[model samples]
Target: MGHGVVLAGLCAALLIIATLAMGCGAMPIRAEDVLGALLRWIGAHPAQGDDAIVLSLRLPRVLMAALAGAGLACSGAVMQGMFRNPLVEPGLIGVSAGSALGAISVIVLGGAASVGWLGSFGVTAAAFAGGLLTTALVYMLGRRRADIATLLLAGVAINAIAMAGIGVLTYMASERQLRDLSLWTLGSLGGTDWRRLLAAAPWIVLSLAWLPLHARALNALLLGEREAGLLGYRTRPLQRRLIALTALATGAAVASCGVIGFVGLLVPHAIRLAWGPDHRLLLPASALGGAILLIGADTVARTMVAPAELPIGILTALLGGPFFLWLLLRARDGGVRA
Candidate 1:
């Protein structure tokens, strides 16, 4: 209804969805028991039976989804603000493609499952590195400083190159590696554990914390570059910093979760349409909405096709595709009105 009301609702929804999510799936633990597991988790006591399942299996996955969703949705919100385009999503800037290439490289060329935790470690680092490298390259290639279009075009070029690189890797991959690579592209939280969660958490957390600090700057940018400059905000540096932060955050998400599609793409827009566009409200609201959306998506992904988990990406894409079409049609209607 209103900003604070919306924010409070989202916070409550996230908690409920997260708790329900932990309790869903094959074992179907009760929500209260799930709460008990969480409360007992802090004591460092090794939980047995359902407690173990809740703590060891579900908790990390749910938290990962929440963090990834938060980072991605926040990034999408920032990117949309920077470009002033409702349809713009974080992946349009090459973070997902770059992260995909990095992970694919590891699965196809670098590691074997037999190598223990090091393999997962390699994939995570490589994905993050790939994202940062792509960001730098995009900034360099698209370095018109004041032209947002150049940066976006640069991202397109990088995405193509990275996709081609992924193609080559896909061709060279062993059967098992190919399967793994394909799944990575499709996205999932199946491999999530505390170790994997910890790896990407800091980047997501850093971006979540740091990105919102620039809300006022984003608000300024909404008024056009010249106007923002008149207001004492240097548009170029601000845009660059926002992109970098969003990339780091989105990159970590893509790396860890493989390539979740729509949370980043749609969540921010949902928040904006329902709650309005003040970044002070929009940013945090997007974060909570993202978490709730992903947790819900993931729960359905794992359950709807029980015993066989659907790739989370596919589920989000399926849901996002129609919503996106609605957005386009809504824009068309708005144009007629104007």
Candidate 2:
């Protein structure tokens, strides 16, 4: 299929899923009601309780999920292209691990009582900082060698250290702290609101904006760094920019929604399977596919257990795990090549 056709289909699916997502939950609004509320909000109509629920509660959560998913999936596609490995993802590079450590520190060391004062933005900022710092460290370690394997190893080491730090934090946590930390690690969009969404938007948007502009560079890099440089591309600078952008995007996503996994790893690969490996098409299609998958997952999470919602992370992991195993088996069979 053509890139345009694939993109159109993904966007259509995202729109449909998002509309369904807006209507699914404990209260359960209809699709028409969801549309009516959105149109009314657009037209500045007077607010009612149901409109308030749809506009104030569900809309922000849905938008956050879509943005976070798109950003992470695009980052994953870039990482895979840069590393020249189909299996590479945002988490494999330690961004999520570092972000988790940062969040754990805030929740455990700062204490539950402090959350009222610290607010959601405080935790988000710390997580973002941690993700960027860890990714930068990994970049520094790998820059001297300029080897993909070395960079991957550095990320692995950093992720191990970050996980250790999280373990220590868990050990030291109070009951309330432990509860909050546990929930955050599991990941959910339940507590999301306009304020948290606004806080994360700029980083995600800015990072995504930088990605498509580098599509040609990413494509060139796929031909190998030396060849890309011979073609007059500044391979090293491109790598640095891509890594920084990935850190910013992934950090904002982890900060906003906690550690939702698999979208990044799974969405890009799925898009590649259907749309071919052209970075130009891959990045945008992955973004749309990610949005659709995440919104659909979030809808299932909310409705599956009714009043009690499943964590979005758990749902993604459950779905992605089997696919991951299949990839491994395919690789073993020598049928998988990226």
Candidate 3:
């Protein structure tokens, strides 16, 4: 418990450091100035400095990314435990694709930029609706048949269809729309402001608070439906709750951050390996671990090229893809991977 607390503290510190460091960018602001501004804003007695960059720019993006990372990782951990499949990512059951399709629909049909918060609003709603709808469809199609395999396969089919829709939208998009879509898809912590953060903060906080409660329940469910049922845990209700929570968190993330992948898949597994597979510890640890990793990656994305920025999502894939492949190979020995 002490170790968990210590590690959580370390993760939080690293997240802050990474956020501040990444915020420095090519913005021509000193770290001290940024820190002082932040302190002053937070009601601390800061000596002096303008909070222009901290308030107007960096703070929101960093916060948004951190929230998104934590949310996605939490969702992934829950999904894996619920499904008893480590390879199961937040999108494995078509949630991500559903979100993407919703965002695209808004982009193409609603003229995303014309309305103020409409872009985010429409996209977020679409994503949530899509995720739930897809899940319901998959569940309905597979449940009566008593086939988990078919359910997953249906998710795949739905994902492919959603991707096809996205492709068509992209193909028909104007140059500006294409550019907007590309950046959104690639993912960035670059252009966030307070309003976006306000939209995202609630869901992330709610998820952070709510998701961990399922730790014991998830552990029980992992032992199979009958075992879980015999232990006074209702399997179907638990599964529904897990799916809903996972979808809500992931949908909110996709709504805010676009489709940043692998944080969810990678973070929980790393925590499980280090701290043992206890969801009680794994859930919060994965949240902090994910935030740290993302903030760190975003820092590199900003500084590695200097004066120019890379998408944070690109950096995550570069780091996570190889690790995922290695995980796959190791799992071939019939151990828990992903």
Candidate 4:
């Protein structure tokens, strides 16, 4: 299919899933009510109690999920393009692990005494800092060698260290802290509000805005660094900019939604399968695909157990883990490459 057709389909699916997500929570607003509530919010109609639920509770959560998923997936597509490796993702380079460690530290150290908005801000800030710092460190390490392999290795080491840190924090955590940490690590859109979404929006939006502008540069880099340089592309600056964007986007997402995985890896790969590896098409399509997947997953998570919502990370992992294994097997069979 053409890019336009694929993107349109993905956008339509995303809208359907998002609407379902808005309607399918514990209170269970009807589809028409959800649309009516949205219309009322825009001053097209009078308000009602259902409008309050949709406007106040569900809308922010749905928007956050879509934004988080789009940011992560676009970050992943950029990473894959920069490294020329299909397997690379935000978590592969320690962004999620570092963010998790930071969030866990806050939960463990800050305690129940730090309740409310201040506490939430503390965690989000720490997570963003951790993710950015880790990405920077990895970038620095890889810069010395100026090679993708070195960067990948640096990421592996950083990821290991970050995970160890998270484990230590987990051990030191009190029961409540541990419980909170577990939920954050597993990921959820359940606790989101307009405030948290606003906090995350600037970073996500800035990163998303910056990434697509480098599509041609990413495409050039795919031809190898020497060839890209030969073609007059500034390899170093492009790589640095892409890394920074990735850090910013992924950090914001991790801060907002916890350690949701595989949207990055899965979305880009699937988009590539359908549309080929053209970065321009791949990047936006991956974002849309990621949004669709996460919204659908979030819907299932909220409604599957009724009053008790599932952590979205578990659902994505359950789906993506098998897909990842299949990719690995396919690569081994010579059907794909790094």
Candidate 5:
């Protein structure tokens, strides 16, 4: 399919899915009602009752999911392109684990602020910081060897350390903190609101804006390091910038919504299969595809059991795990690299 057609399709799917998600949940507002509520709020009409519920509660979480999804998908796309490995993803570098550890630390030691907006912002900040720290550590370690294998090994080491830290924090947590940590680690959009959106959206947006600017660099890098150097791109500096931007995006995502997996790994691979591995189109398409997927998964997660909600991370993993195995089998059977 042409990039235009695919992008338009993704945009349409995102709209349809977002509208559908808006009408889902215990209240189950009609689609028309959801549209009307949106129009009414847009038109400066005072929202009350159902309108308030849709405008205030449903909308923010949906937007949060979209932003987080887009960030992760973009991060994954770039990671795969830079590493020249379809299996590579942002979390491979320990951003998610580091973010989780940071948030867990705050939850266990910081008291009941997780329930408040200010405290929520603190957790987001700490998570962002932790993610950056870990990514930087991995990047520096990898830079010493200056090869993809070294970088990946560095990432593995960092991932293990972050996870171990998370485990220690989890073990030390009080019951309430433990419960909170469990939910956060598992991931959800359930706690999002306007304020939380304010806290997390900018980092995702910044990453979204920043990563695509390097599309040409990524395309060059994928042509092999020697070729890219012959083309005048300083590969080491390019890698540094990519890692930094990816950490920002992935950190914000993990911080805001906890450790939602697979969107990063899954969306880019799917995009590559559907549209070919052109980073220019791959970057934006992955963003839209990611939004569609997470919104759809989140809708299923929230409405699956009505009064009770499933963690979206679980849903994505459940879906991505089987798909990953199939991918592995395909590779083993001599399938082409994306």
Candidate 6:
């Protein structure tokens, strides 16, 4: 309870700070103006002149970052527990690549975001389908008559294929499409709006709700497949459901915010260090931690370079890469199991 309170407080504090920071700088708006704009937005009073900067642009980006962070982090925690491997994540298992492929295909070939509702849905549908397809393929190929190692290897192969396809798509794309593709690959939470948030929130909430129910199943599966089967937990069914849910959450997140990485991987690792390997607590803690970290990263990305923003993905890699290596080294020295 104490730990939970601390985490909740941290999350709230970081969110408020990020929200305020987002409104300031770049456009160089005053704090009073930002406060006035917020008051107006809440039906207090209308701000005169252009309120687009705060109301239309930055607010949505911050909200999207929060949602994306939660989605990805929760997805990562689920994957790690399902696979019984801390190293596994959406990016590692090909979900992000698959989602990217689908979205990119829509932009490059389906006239995405330009052709009204048909085109908009086309991109999202393509992304979801691509993500599911990739997960299915990985599951099929990874199983050596239903073996997890085989599934993992197959996922690696599929990830490679999807990445190669991305390269080809990049080469063949038009100038504008290529630019959009490049930006998406780098990842960002800019340009979000209430409509976009509404479209994404349900999926995020649905995915998050699965964590508590699957906590015991993940714990059982961690004891090994044969043991889990003998222990009367249908391993395969749970695994399938986990993979499906992960694909849904991760695909939606990538589609909405591009391919933001590390939040999933990094948050789970940090939570484990704090609370140990109890998925029940790990899930929510990691979710909050991920939201706070990504919000901070996004804040840094937007502010560090002033008007020109750095990609959120770049910021995570710059920070997470070295940190991941250090984790690996410590894990090796301590001889920790997956």
lDDT score, candidate 1, position 203 = 82
Give lDDT tens digits, candidate 4, residues 1-338.
78788888888888888888898877888888898889888986778878988998899999998999999999989988876778777776777888777777777877622576677667767777787788778656654675545766777888889878888888898886776676667898877889888878888899888898998888998888899999999898888788778887887788778899888989999989978999888988888888888888888998899788899999999988898788778867877665
Candidate order, TM-score descending: 5, 2, 4, 1, 3, 6
Whole-model lDDT, candidate 5?
0.83
Q: Mark the regions of model 2 whose C-alpha exceeds 4 Å error after superposition.
A: 110-119, 136-157
Residue-level lDDT of model 6, residues 92-208, one tens digit each, is: 668888988888888887657566555645666777788778767665554434444454566678778888888888888888787678656888876667766666667777878
Root-mean-square deviation per candidate: 3.2, 2.7, 3.0, 2.7, 2.5, 3.0
For each candidate, the alpha-carbon lDDT, in order, equals 0.81, 0.81, 0.74, 0.82, 0.83, 0.75
The lowest-lDDT stretch of 10 consecutive residues in candidate 4 is 140-149
Instruction: Tell me the spans in candidate 1 whose CA falls farther than 4 Å from its real position.
Output: 44-49, 112-122, 132-160, 334-338
Give TM per candidate.
0.88, 0.90, 0.88, 0.90, 0.91, 0.87
Per-residue lDDT of model 5, residues 1-338, tens digit only: 78788889889989999999999988889889999999989999877558988988999989999999999999889888876767667666676888777877777778644567778777877787787787677656644565545665776787788788888888888787776776667899887789888888988899899898999889998887789999999998888888888888887788778888778889999989878888989999999988888889999999998788999999999988887678767766768363
Question: Who is ahead in TM-score, 1 or 5?
Answer: 5
Query: What lDDT does candidate 2 reach at residue 196?
Result: 80
Instruction: Report the alpha-carbon TM-score of model 5 versus the true structure.
Output: 0.91
* Candidate 5 residue 254 C-alpha distance from true site, Å: 0.7
Per-residue lDDT of candidate 2, residues 7-121 (tens digit):
8888888888899889888788999999999998999988765898899899999999999999989988988888776766767668788887876777677653255534566
| Each model's total of backbone clashes | 0, 0, 0, 0, 0, 2
Tally clashing residue pairs in candidate 3: 0
Model 3 CA RMSD to the hidden true structure, in angstroms = 3.0
**Any runs in candidate 5 off by more than 4 Å, and if so which?**
110-118, 137-158, 336-338
Which should have the higher lDDT, number 3 or number 6? Answer: 6
- At residue 22, give the lDDT of candidate 1: 96
Better of 1 and 2 by TM-score: 2
